[model samples]
Target: MFAGHDPYLVALSVIVAILGGYTGFGLAARIRGTPGLARRLLLAGAAGFLAVGIWTMHFVGMLAAPIPPAAAYLVLPTIISFLICALVVGISLFFVSIGDPSRQRVIASALLLGAGIVSMHYVGVHAVSGPFHIVHRPGMILLSSLIAVLSAYGGLRIYLARQGGLRLVLSAVAFGIAVSGMHYTAMHGMTFSTMPLDMVPMSDGLVASAQVLSLVVALLCFVIAAGFLLFLVPEPRPRPLAGFPGGFYPASEAPGPVSEGLQTASRSDRSVMTTAPLGGIGQPRQLPVQRIPVEAADGTRLVDVTEIRAIRADAHYTMVHDGQRERMCSWSISEAETKLDPAVFIRVHRSHIVSLPHVAFLRKEGDGAIVELDGPQPTIVPVSRAKIAEIRARLGLTKTVPPRH
Candidate 1:
């Protein structure tokens, strides 16, 4: 029979689980912000810790109970439990990697992670010593699974939403409770026992809580060390790839040998030393916005950057607004913003970036401001309430608008 009641261990496990889950989420969130090899190593180490922590926490809960003749786990299945936790951590972090994950994708990833957690719990359950048939109450099992999924979803949501301070801690606590609750609930739902006379005594191979702790600590240390080594390894600097034209180029116009300074600029960017009368073999590279080259719908024609006015996020790529024409470029708004000169182009909204020089007038309508540009064809851009001050400063509007109620 399994260990009966162990509230103290369960409570302790819950606390540990929450802290581990939260720590993983926090570290995973920081992964992208960290540059180069450090980010990759840190992400792996963080994922490993979260996984191992959850696995060990379950065993800790197991240790809380005292079964007849003492309870021990089979070695192989116990090891597998740790792997399941790591899988869950890896999957959760992967979902967070997407800049803007869809709701369905996020929920699905969380549900899958929870399922792995559930699997880990059962695997540990099976690791119990002795040949015993285990039966689970269907209703209880489903309820526990639901709890795991919901808990995982909540934690993922908080991490993706970038919740801070009290909220984040609360989310961690909630996740921990879910982990503990699932373990105890599953433990109670199952009935496992062997015939007294036929039951085999536990052997040296059986896992103890101490063994689990040592294993987890060792794996955590390994992960951290691997990450540190990765951090030490310098990442290769990105070299400028072939210039983008999406077509055959004349021999004279073919890409020249790339220089060190030009390596940072995208190959797709159309850069010239200068378009001025003095433009020749060696002049400073053109401004970022001026360097952008656009391929026409026919692909045979290329448009200069001066023709472009504004850019907006459209599906996966950005829509280049050039007078009456619109061209789709395979670049995200954020990516495009980095290449453009900040003084000329400003990201006015999440999806919208506009050329400041194109602005003819700013009209105030209630709480919102609309920018109408002066050109052969006028384009109206809506400014969000959050960007009001930024718009004012950029547009050089000395008058301060009253705050909205």
Candidate 2:
């Protein structure tokens, strides 16, 4: 016969699952902004959190079920199950984050993740050692597997979309449902049969008591709570005085004489400035930026202004497309515009800027226009209604019309 589950414990398990999902997904979202070792570490941490969440939820659900009094958990199998979850989760994340994740890659990753969840669930279930045998209905196992796959795909899509606020919360909730639903559904189809009195349980293998398991679960819960809190802490904004015209400098290294001009320059003029020695007396001259700072896997590198085809805004930072591939830039869109020569580069849209010299094609699209920049991998930048006329004039496309007939 099926075992009854504690409703309160079930609810608690769901909560733990949701919290873990939220924290793990939040960490993964930051992987895009980070580079190299930092990105790998973050990915690992995210996987660990997610694995812990799934493992914890499964055990909590198991605790809720009324198993035979003689049943105990095998330490080795329980530990192996958790390791399996972590390994698969890490592999899945790595697959998606490595390069441009295609549709096939995403699907493959999702399949792997879903299979990992199912494997962890069953492995954990089989860890129970006692004078009883467990059997699961084939149909229910298939249904649970389907739910796992679908839920995993949905979660990955949401993460890729990168929408924050309400969407992230909803995704976490859905993930919680997916994990808990699969566990309970499988449990529903499970039947336990008592073993014969002569049957002997293994005595050599180490086992964990319910009390010890409770302590472990409590410790994991605390770790998840701590991670959740740390994730909520907002990143400190860089101080205004910590930047220079051509690049960023420490506040302590900032020149004193130019500080006034730096503070007084308008957004557009901030990047166009000249400075003299600390005590020298001379009129300031123009010193436009020649190179743009961008981040790469190896390290921070500078891209020549002439090499930039387009710059797209990414929150507080910008993405620099250097005719080949896009690289993350530490500068804001406003900063990029101010620093680059206005004669060649133009801010065509709120979030986009294009190099006029690289303009290969321009076409009117509805109320605005689109300009294709010539490069190995051509980029299309949108032209806002306000900037359409200016973009046309800069590209020598503006034409005079004859008098009306």
Candidate 3:
């Protein structure tokens, strides 16, 4: 007849499972900010869960009563254990990905719980060490499932708390402590080999306590490790200066071909002859400062500066200034100057090459016109008027605009 199981190894596996689970969850949460990246992490975490579960089961099983040698059967049970654990973890991750739990963070915890059960059952089997059978009793299975669920729920809750604005460090510490307790409780229920009632060594309690303590420490370490993994994934920060080359410059700052070629010229040619006329065709002359002339949409007077007090680019004919008024006007800028300063910004509409700073909102209009300058500005800048559908796509907006007539 097959003997009973060992309690010490059961507890140890529980602790390990929790740690592995939490680590996976934290990883998924950190990268969730990216759209598809979190799903990949979840799937990968499921595989990891299976591996850890198998390893823990093997080791824990050996720790039980010494198993009689049956090498062939050993590998089979291990495979079976790993598959069961993997299925649980994979299913859990599927729910997590679908539910959108903080970048599929729930995957980790689920894996931990599932693997813990696999490890415990196999470890118990190892203690028996015989061609034994485990009659799958409903009560034992139910109890094991409950333990896994509790551990998984705890792990997931800790991660969610971080996303919900809880202090991450504190939450991790709390989670680790909780995992330790849950795993220890799970270990208490194992029914192992019954040698003689009084024959068990006194040192068994010391060994058992040490194992449980080790499990707790492992869990604590896992929590810290998971926390660090979450931090490892990088998030996009605001570019210091919104424009390129790390500084803000107008669209006219782009260099001209002549100037570019001159810079590329080698050596002594760098110095220009002062004898060259102050301004000439072959000489480097101070090109006229092409003023980006600003105008009022109401067709006001042409002036050096915008009278609307805050006029900013809104494509070719559109602009916004003084918080709400929209101006649409025809304007010109020297092509040479624009080529030099490509950073000037992109034109959003025929009337709207809005300065990045001035644009407050972007919305789609019903008539194939993407409505820019969304605030109180009375003028609904028509984007469809220009071939600006590409801009809409870049902004991740649907083509809500009607087809141009």
Tens-place lDDT digits, model 2, residues 264-343? 33434523332322233354634568999877545678889999999987556777888876667878776676667778
Please give the lDDT score at residue 188 for candidate 1. Answer: 72
Ranking by lDDT: 2, 1, 3
Each candidate's clash count: 0, 0, 24
Give the number of the best model, judged by lDDT. Answer: 2
Candidate 3, residues 239-306, lDDT tens digits: the string is 23332233422222223443333323332232222112334437653432224333332334333222
Evaluate residue 395 in candidate 1 and report its C-alpha lDDT on the 0 to 100 scale: 79
lDDT for each residue of candidate 1 in 1-405, tens digit (9 for 90 to 100): 234657676666766676676666656755644546866876786787578667867877766654444445678888888888897779777766544355787888888888999999989877777545567899989988998898788877766544234555776677777788877877777776656655665455646654565466456545544543453465353333233233322111223333222323332342232121132344454446555544342342445656667776643456666766445566666567666766577666556778888888887766767787666767777765455566677778877789999
Stretches of candidate 1 off by over 4 Å are: 1-4, 131-133, 163-167, 199-405
TM-score of each: 0.54, 0.69, 0.38
* Residue 95 lDDT in candidate 1: 65
